[model samples]
Target: MHNIKDLRKNLDYYKKKLLNRNYNLNIDEFVNLDKDNRNLISKKEKLEQEKKILSKSKNKANFEKSKKISEEISRLNKDQALNKKKLDFILHTLPNLALDDVPIGKDEKSNKLIKKFGKIRDFNFTPKSHVEISSNEIDFETSTKLSGSRFVVLKNKLALLERALINFMLDVHTIQYKYTEVSPPLIVNEDVMFGTGQLPKFEEDQFEIKFNNSDQRKFLIPTSEVVLTNLVRDSFTKKDDLPLRFVASTPCFRREAGSYGKDTKGMIRQHQFYKVELVSVVEPKNCLIELDRMLDCAKKILDILEIPYQIVLLSTGDMGFSAEKTYDIEVWIPSENKYREISSCSSCGTFQARRMGAKYKINNNNEFLGTLNGSGLAVGRLIVALLENNQNEDGSVTIPDALKKYMNNLDKI
Candidate 1:
């Protein structure tokens, strides 16, 4: 949400920004409505002032006109509500400005790779895709029977390995990186989704359910990002607490609405998956720096896992709707012989805080804090990358040295 004052003060500037973001708001009408509301507020204030004056004076005629003035006030109050609704509708569609450093491009192909890490593992024997080799351990048929497509049942080694990966990432983030760990609710209200800029735009990508016997709706969180970022919802904190860091391991559910037939063969994409997510709330000045720190935290996970990966700065068109800038960590998959995104780190700036009513007392002055979120690692994809990158000659998967301790010292599966 943008500042209302911005709409009134420089409607022309905001109008252009809205158009740039492809918002379909009627700029003239929106400005006119706000002007009308401002006029009503002025009239209301004048009426109240007159009433106070009349009450003090012994002017009988002025007292007699008071009833008519009170009725006008009531009518104006009703009009105020309508105008407020119009203002809210316009503000809801307004988008955050793109970061100056964000590359201007149409799509994913234009994303700039900032750096690459690790070496692609070489395999002597025929390397099977994770989908084929893990077939015995993944009961996709049962998943289909129980639910539908884009779901899987990981059994035995795969299940254990996924759990180990989640724990491994969490330990690294909390024990090593100073991020406080949290286990937030998997279901959140609509406001929480909107706070993270997921609602009013990408509703189809989420699974929503109604609360029992209530009009309230709750959606299964598409990512821990939703829960972790919304933790500051409707909050005003001291500036000294400017940077609040949190991490959580959670099961994320997504509808994946547009991807009808893509990556259906394996765990490359799924309806539900475990992800260890990182979120930070900071002062405006620190947001970009924190974005780098958060990305490093994510890269550290892949580093420890010994996975070859590269960092790509997402092009404007490929960036998430809420994100001003995004950096994707793509791990090399030997089977595909290319890099695929394993995690995405993004700085939303103050875009989310404004929507969530999250602000801080900066220098003892009120200001909205900025928010950012990124996947420390998506457990399923990381597992897929590991299996594909570290496959042994005899069809076994070698565990990375860092995760071996968490896997009870088992080096391979």
Candidate 2:
């Protein structure tokens, strides 16, 4: 959500920035609505003044004029009420402007790679996809029979690996990265979803719960980011509590509405997957700096897992709805012969803060706080990378040293 005052004060400044993102709000509508609202207020004020004079005068002859003025004020009030609704709708449609440093591009094709890590393995034997590597333990037919397409059931060691991932990520984030671990509700209300910029614009991608046809809309969270960040909604913190870091491991549910044909073959895209999400709330001034620190925490997962990956700055058009700037961490997949996004660390600035009504008080002045979220790592996709990269010729996977403790010190799975 943009500060309407900023848009009113510097329309061209924001108009120009939004252009690089291939988006433009209809400022003309805003101008007309603002004009009408101001005019109505002025007219109502003058009418009220006239009524005040008539009342003071106690003149019977002024009664008709006073009655006419009253009706006009009532009419203006109705129009103002309707105008406010429309203005709010328009305001909600506008997306966050990209940060000036974000690469200007039409899409992901133009993303800029900021850094790369580890070496792409040179496999002696043709590497199999994660689906093939875990074929015995991955029961696709049963998944389809029970839950339909875009779902898979992991059995035996494969299922165990998923559990190990959740525990390992939670331990790493809580102990190593110093993020407070939180267990949040998976089913959240509409306001909670809206606070994180997941509703209104992207409702189709959500799984709205219709339990007993309840009137209140509740959704299965698409990411733990929705829950972790909303922890501060409609709340205020002291200046000393400048930065709040939270991490949660949970099952994320998504409809994959717009992603119809992509990654349909494997767990790369699923109806349900587990993720360890990281979120931070900080003073607006530190948002950009915090983004880098947050990304490092996420990168530590790949470092611990010994997975080769690269960090890419998301182009303007590729950023999330609330994100002003984003860094996508794409892990190497030997079978796909390309890097695929396993996590996205983003700085949303005050975009989500305004929506959440999250604030901080400094020197007696309350201001919106900045919010940041990232996938510490998506467990399912990380599993894909692990199974494919660490596969032995005989069809077993060697556990990475970092996860071995969580996996009961077993060397291989």
Which pairs of residues collide in model 1? none
Per-candidate RMSD vs. true structure? 2.4, 2.5
Query: How much is 129 displaced in model 2, in angstroms?
Result: 0.4
- lDDT of model 1, residue 412: 89
User: Which candidate leads in TM-score?
Assistant: 2
Candidate 2, residue 357: the lDDT equals 96
lDDT tens digits by residue: candidate 1, 1-413 = 77788667887776655454455567678878888988989999999888788778878988788878888888988998899887776677666766767776667877898999998777776778897777889889999999999999999989989999999999999999999999899999999999998887788999998768788889999999999999999989778776899999999999999999798888989999999999999998888999999999999998888889999999766888778789999999888888999899998888899999999986667788889999999998998898988887778888888888888899888
For model 2, state the Cα shift of residue 5 in Å: 0.6
TM-score per candidate, in order? 0.92, 0.93
The TM-score that candidate 2 achieves is 0.93
After superposing candidate 1, which stretches have Cα over 4 Å from the reference? 7-26, 51-64
